[model samples]
Target: MARGKEQPARRGGGGRAIGRVIPWAVIGLWVAAVAVLAPFAAGLDKVKSDKVVDYLPSGAESTTVAALEEKLPGGGVNDFVVVYYRAAGITADDRTTAERHLAVLDRKYPGPPTDSAPPSIPAGENGPHTVGADGDKTTGSSSRVQDSRDGKALLFAHSVGTASGEPSAYLPALRKLLEDRPAGLEAKVTGPGAIEGDIDAVFDGIDAKLMITTVIVVTVLLILIYRSPVLWLLPLLAVGCAALISMAAVHLLAKNFGVVVNEQSAAVLVILVFGVGTDYALLIVARYREVLQTEADTNRAMSVALRSAGPAIIASAGTVAAGLLCLLAADLNSTSGLGPVGAVGVACALIAMLTLFPALLLVLGRWVFWPKVPKVLPAGVTGAVAGQARWDRLGAWIDRRKGLAAFGSVVFLGAVALGLLGGPGSLRSQDQFVKTPESVSGFTLVTRHFPHIGGQPITVIAPTAKKDAVLEAAEAVKGVSQVVPGRSGAEYAEITVFPKDAPDSPAERRTLKALRAAVDKVEPAAAVGGPSAQNLDTATTSARDEKIVIPLVLVVITLILGALLRAVAAPVVLILTVVVSFAAAIGASTLVFEHIFGFKGIDPGLPLLGFLFLVALGVDYNIFLMHRAREESLLHGTRRGILGSLSATGGVITSAGVVLAATFAVLATLPLVPMAELGFLVAFGVLLDTLLVRSILVPAVGLRLGSRLWWPSALGRHTDPEDADGQASVPIGRERALRN
Candidate 1:
């Protein structure tokens, strides 16, 4: 009989163990495959090599004068103009140097205007058009400050790219090109691009800051968790490898698949690795310890823990991955890129925790609890705090009175939530990037010197082939104090008008409505497309998504919680808790925006962003609690189960929260408005989830519902252990509880 049982047990152990680890592999492989495509990682390390070299004004002046009339676009339509004013005359040498620098940069630029206009006389609408400032003070020249008295000054500026791309990367090269000039000349490339370029410069310091913080925080947490430098070794190794490979994959994918990582996504990746990876390892290790107390044999305990805890971890990872995927609905490309990349990181965390972690456990399990001698303790206390009498006493004290634990969670979350009143807005604008020095300088320079440079002039285009109705459509608008019959070409007609600003300001909205109404009357293939048109498109896009994404993510998150818990009520309660927390997070972020940022309205996109992050991370702790509660309840009973689960995983969750919170908090240091808001919002949300939702609401809900919480009809039901479905099928605390 013994031989027969032993043979079957060995076969079952080998087969079942392999089966249990499938979710880990599947989740891991799927993500790794998607992330390996970044092409822009390093640029041969030369910060200022081969930038723009020359930009010269040709004196073929009168010869090309007709070309200028053909494309006589106003100041706003003109690209950037660089101003290099000297105290003396600008000779061929000065012109030669500035022109060469500008030319080098100009060569790399994808030529102005994405449309098909022949590259004729690149100066027509696109080139080194020179102009004097409003006045040359000494000469009292009417053409202004752009020109120096002795002609020693040179001004250089051009539209780098649609005024859409950030300038930091390009600005440095421009600055260096000027700095490397044959001396005595000052060149400042003041444009939207230049300003953005400077802000990007500040970001260079971030990678170093993140590296130090990760090392310190991880080292400290490891020391506290394992108490043995030896045991902390494997988990640290796992996180490092996972983070490195995950990042490499994101960059690689970005390089190849066209998914570019913005500053926000790049910053979030480090924190994601530490927090998510650490959470997975902690769950597996805690379960492994529980298995040890009863199994005695280390191998059996290791196999046993993997078979049980691995699925929960994988399911937790799925929720995170799915939450990130919802970003595809966002209008911003920066946010859209985050959706898939964050999922990839979660996948990496799952893999490292499941495979490499198990192998490490096999080698290091014996020595993991060293110095303290591996003595078994009652259920729920990790060896990390095993020897501390005061902690044990406190743990016991909490076990004795659970009500206080419940109340404290309510008080803390409710208070932090009070800030919710400040959140506002419906759209985050590109203008937010203007808060930087480069942007401010560019804005001031343009506003002061180029009065006609504020807006993208509205252009109505109809085929050169259509004249009657098209021209009629153009003539029907009410705001047109004047309409110039059509200028640019047979193919393009330019209508100049002084229409009121509608949709943005109330009075303007009225003017726009009338203009739109008149346009409708003419109905000439008319679809709006300039700055106002883009805003209308953006508002439409945001409104449509608002009606959709959040509710959908919430539903998906709820179903995920239910399925992960394997209980009907548990998922429902967890969903509700997460929803309430999400509301509070949004409300709090709103308050931060209104009172602190002093912005008018919330960015239309901020709500979805806050909602998704809160739901995802908040539910992460929920998974920890439910899995812990079920394990502890089966081993002990309902009341003790809640206490035991809290004690075992609570500390780790809180530590993960601290690291995540701190990393996101770093975003506030950026020069851009959106980044500052995003940083604080995400950091504060994580803190609320870690401190309140996981530790308090979950335990309190568990306690309040008691056995009823796991109903419909049974969940991890512990009793006679002979049944195939019995919860205590292999519980360590079962024998002791039976004896008691």
Candidate 2:
């Protein structure tokens, strides 16, 4: 009999050994994969394309111009302005030094070397231009050095050959050459080329900075939530692995599938991985801790925990992935590319948290909780018996005043949402940066000195046969200051039109519109493009994308929620609550932006990106609560189940919310206006959803509706005896009682 018993015990031990081996094997494989792909992942930034045209809508006028311009004589032209200023009035010496510097630039960085003979010039017109040492003559289309009306400043236009295909590559050397100045004269390079360099410089080192800040923020929050020196490291380590995997995957996708990754998308990807990964880890860990209070065996506890929390985690990830994927429908290439990049990050985080996180916890066992170690309960004791009486009382209070709580919550959110009406208008390119760069300062100096000249001229392309007609119409437009004819290709000619207003001013936008209308009437095939035109087109496209994409995102998320909840009423209510939460957050942010922070105006893409993140991510907390409540309702009935789920999930979900909010808040520390605005809106929105919407409004509504909250689901039809009696269906003191 002893031999027989030992044989059975040995067989059982072998079975358990296999279970232990599987998790380690999975972890080891992931580690090896990460090591193999780490190099490629590190090179992702090397492959990113930040071309201006890359971000615009494919069919936009600006995009068409960019493509056509590349096919011109020297491939294209990189145009910039060198402004020389003196508060005492520009002196002769200033002009001499500026001319000498221009000559040096011409010799060193000659424009496209002409292959064909100079075109014959018409009589009385500027004679056929001679190729200067700069490679192209300063033609009628080029603005040569001219004194400002005030005599305080002089501006000269410089063009370089774009045949090399990297206009920005020449900026650093040009900026350096211009840095040596003559006394009493200040020279600054401003225009598209210089501005592009400044923007690229801002994005430089952004990836490393973003990673450090996000990691620090997440680490701090995890320490606070876990309160365990050791426990926090587990999720942090898991999330870090997820980030690495995500980067590698994104790199591969971009390299193989031509996915676009810019500074914005890359930064957002890191935050998503850490934020969403930590959230999934929290849910799993919380459930595991609860299970540990009953099932002393660590493996058994995790098994039960995963089974309980897996559906919510999986469903939440699915919803986020689906919502982000909807961005593919966006007309803006940058916005569309963000969809896949962000979705990949979220998917990686989910896989790591569900697999690596659980495996690590099992391997480390209950001791990982350290000083706050959970203990197996005594026979009659329960999981919630230790210190949750506050949550119980809070639940009871809300249950009693359901109507008051619901009404009060709605009123508060609605009032905050009214601030949307006072928000400033669309943001312009000049206002895109949080802090002024050298190029912007230079542009401002030009505006002060040359009050009549636009910062960047509007470029128009018309049929070569109608060149004179196009120029005449452009010059006759209301706001036009001058029109200069440029190079002519096979069938088209380029004209540079200077407007009276500043490049990004409201007056300038109107001028561009008027110019377009006038030019189109004279030359039907003409196209208008330039820095200002690009900005206008971007804003217009963003607005159109908002109208189309917002409704689609809503439909997608609603269908997802409906499937996950298995109840039409519950999904509708959740969607409405999240939408209200989003509106309230945007409204509150608009006030902060306009009055407190003094932002110029909102980015045109703000509403769409804000809605995409707020609604999809906002509903995550609701999903956690409702999924748990639905499970409880099967056992305890709807009202009791709602209270029980809130009590059980309240702390963990709040912790998750804080983690996510803090992660996004990292973007506020960046120097870009759009990123900062997006950060604040999403962060504040999440907090509102977590603390007020999920905790107060959602619970109150669930209590008020009772079983009807679940409409058509089996839980809606099932009612416990205690629910009918208007008593607590299950005692709230302990997890066992709450579940019972």
Candidate 3:
């Protein structure tokens, strides 16, 4: 008998040793993965493109113009204006200096060589400079230089071949050429090339700046939430690993599959990884802490924690990933690309938190909690009683006034939602920068000095046979200042229509609308496109995508909730509450945007992108609540279950919310207007959902419905409230202890 007992004891010890080895093995594997991926991840920013055509809908007229322009004689071009300004007037010396600058530009970057070029290329295409019959460069007649009506601005139209490479490369040289301006003359390079350069300069620091800000925000919030210096660092380190892995995945996808990534998408990726990953970490750690208060073995406690919290974390990640993938259906390339990029970030976060985080916590054992470490309680003393008393009382209070709570919450949310009625309009290009860059300032100067001359002209493509009719109709449009015929291909002809108003002004949009209508009447095959047209298409497509994607996301999330909760009524109610929360968030954000922040209009894609993030992420808190409630309902029935789950999960979920909101809030610190607006809206919306909708409104609804909230499931049939309270009030591990 003694020999048999010894063998059994030895087997048990070996089993324990294997369990200890597993967690370290998992950590080692992840460390190796990160080491291998760090190099590729660092290169993700180098591949981002800021080209406008890259973001436009493939079917849009502007996109078509870009494609056709690429096939032209010089293989596409970058056209911009060199504006020489003087407060008083253009002096003789200014004119002389300008002529000399133009001559140097023509000689250095001359247009395509002409041997009386093909029909595809317009004649006299010796490039930006004029060439004599002898094939020699002419002096100063290369580019078309015009003087503003007020004589304070001198505008020179410069076009460079893009076949060579990115036109933005020429900006540095152009800036250098303009550096030696005449005294008292302000020479600003204001055009597509210059604007692109400024935008690129800002994007150069996006990854580092966004990462530092996000890490700082998350660390501060974590320290406050955990109140344990050591505990907070674990989640931050895990999230950093997730971010690195996410960046590598995105880079690989972009390289292998031609995925489009812009600076905006890349920055948002870092925020999502840190925010969502930390939220998952909080949920797991909270459960682990609770288990530690009852279980003696650290490994057993971790196993129990993972078992309880794993489903909720997975479900939360699923809803967000599915909702983001819906962006693939979007017509806008930038919005579509963001869908995969964000989905990858969320997926990587989930993987890291689920595997790496739990492994780390288990490896560190009970001491990870430090000074506040939970001590295993004595027999019959449950962990649930003291920790959940406050939540229990609040749940009881809301249950008593369920009717009032429901009505009051709706009234308040609806009142806040009225702010959407103001119609903030669409964001214009001039307002795209938070603080105006030099390109914008130069454009402004040009507008002031050249009031009669159009800055960026509207480009129209028509069938070659209908060129004259297209030109006549275009010129006859109300706000058109001039119609200049451009190069004609075999099938199509390009015409540049200069508008009387500024390029992105409301008046110009109207003018573009009228011009399209008129040109289409005479030349049915004609298409009008330019900077203004691109903006119009973006707004229209965004509105359409909102209608389609919102309904799909609601349906998808509802199914996920229903499947997870195993109850139809609860899922329906949860969906309804989240929708209301989204509306309230938008309404509240709109008020702050217009009244407090002084924003005139929002980005065209803001409503759709904001809705996607708010609804998907907002539903996460509800999932955390309802998932735990469902588990408790199995033993405690629906009423007590709701109260118990809320009490238990309240602190952690709230901490998670604040962490997420703070991470998103970091976007406001960036100089980009769209990012700032998105950050504010998402951050505000998340807070509203956390503080009001999830905490009060959802609980109130659940209380009023009671067991009926679990309809179509056995839990819906009310059980003895006294029996459930007596049994479930015991800490989870205590029942097993009593049995032992």
Clashes within 3 Å, all models in order: 69, 0, 2
Predict model 1's lDDT versus the native: 0.57
Local accuracy by lDDT, each model:
0.57, 0.81, 0.79
Model 2 compared with the native: what TM-score?
0.91
Give the per-residue Cα lDDT of candidate 1 at 200. 58
Best by TM-score: 2
TM per model? 0.68, 0.91, 0.90
lDDT of 3 by residue, 362-438 (tens): 88888888778899887556576334777777788877887788899989999988878885678876667778877
True-structure Cα RMSD, model 2? 5.5
The ten-residue window of minimal lDDT in model 2 covers 116-125
In candidate 2 the C-alpha lDDT for residue 508 amounts to 88
Selected candidate, larger lDDT, 1 vs 2: 2
> Evaluated with lDDT, which candidate comes out highest?
2
lDDT of 3: 0.79
